[model samples]
Target: MPKLWNETIDAHREQVREAIVNVTSTLVFEQGLRAVTMSQIAEHAGIGRATLYKYFPDVETILRTWHARQIDSHISELTQVRAGAGSPGERLDAVLASYAHIAHQTGSHDRELVKFLHPDERIVNAQNQLREIVRQLIEEGATAGELRDDVDPAELANYCLHALSGAAELTTAEAIARLVALTAAGLRPPQS
Candidate 1:
């Protein structure tokens, strides 16, 4: 096959795979995970069962892929927020706020669905990525005198993640913001 044809085929395959993932996610979200079947997903995705099998062996595989995609998207969004033009303190605030918002939204998902998705290694890797991002920001802030130097950056990073994880239980944007503010406050240097 010509190079252009090969690239086109690859792009088409990716689009089909993404479509299947999206359809599976919608079915799982709207119909509940247990109620969603592979046949239903294949039909809803407009692909034959055989084609769906080529992409995913079972409903669980499809759901896992969808969850992995969501994790990637969330990480990418936070990376952008961290990279946005701002002072280190301001960037840190933005990143924390973005992360808290995601946690708050995810908290509303069905408990069963959350449980199903939470055990994957991808979640652990994503968390480690999130920690690294926050750690780098903390180091920047500490060096800039915006955050306390008394605490190690890695320790502060862990503290920030654990503190903000509580945002999952928060009910309102105001509450989440308050939580983020309190977490940020803990990072601030003490006055003489």
Candidate 2:
């Protein structure tokens, strides 16, 4: 095929795949994970069953792909927040607040969906990525005398993550901000 033709074909394939992932996500959210079927996804996405099968072998695969995409997007956002121009403390605060906001947004997902997705390897890797991002910031903050150095940065990173997870249960932005503030406070050195 000509180069333009190949590019067009690839673009079309990407669009179709995106549609499949998005339609599957909506169906799963509306019908519950176990209740959603590949056929329903195909019909809802305006694709044929055979095309859907060609793209994804099962509903679980589609769901996993959708989740992986979400994780990538989130990690990318966190990375941007980390890289943004700021002092170590300011950057750390912004990243934690961004993460807390993410938790609040996704907190409404069904418990069943959460259970199904939590054990995947992608989740493990994403957690590790999050930890590393926070750990690096903690190290920088400690060097800058902005955070406590008595504890290991790795441990403090875990502390921040675990403490900020409370944002998930929060009902208001004010509550999430408070949770982030409290979590950030825990990283500070004791006053003389």
Candidate 3:
């Protein structure tokens, strides 16, 4: 095949895969994980069952692929949040709040979905990346005397990640903000 022809084929395949991932996500959200099926996904995606099968062997594979995409998007969002205008302390605050909101939004997802998607190595690596983002901010703040020097940055990073996770259980933005505030407070240096 010509180069242009090959590029076109690759692009078309990506579009089809994107459609499959999106349609399956909507179906899973509407019908629950176990209720969704390959046939339903194919119909919703406007693809044939054979095409769907060619792209994904099973529903779990589709869901895992969808989750990987979500994780990648989230990491990009957090990186942007960290890079947003602010002093080190201010940037840290924004990153922590952004993460809390993300946790709150995703927390509403099906518990079974969370359980299934979280054990993958991709999730473990994404989590480590998240912690590294937090750790860098904490170190920056500490260097500027904005955060506590009494604790290790790695420890504070762990503390912030675990602490803000409670936002998932919170039902209100006000409540999540309060939780973020409390978590951020723990990072501040003690007053004389």
The C-alpha TM-scores of every prediction are 0.93, 0.97, 0.97
Predicted candidate 2 versus true structure: per-residue lDDT over 22-114, tens digit per residue = 998898889898898887988999999999999999988888899999999999999999999988888999999999998887788877988
Q: Which stretches of candidate 2 lie over 4 Å from their true place?
A: none
Best by lDDT: 3
Question: What is residue 134's positional error in candidate 1, in angstroms?
Answer: 1.0
The whole-model lDDT of each prediction reads 0.92, 0.92, 0.94
Judged by lDDT against the true structure, how good is candidate 1? 0.92
Model 1, 1-192: lDDT tens per residue?
899999999999999999998998888889898998988988998989999999899988888888998899999999999999988999999999999999988888878899999999999999999999999999999999898999899999999999988988999999999999999999999889
Worst 10-residue lDDT window, candidate 3? 24-33
Better of 1 and 3 by lDDT: 3
TM-score of 1: 0.93
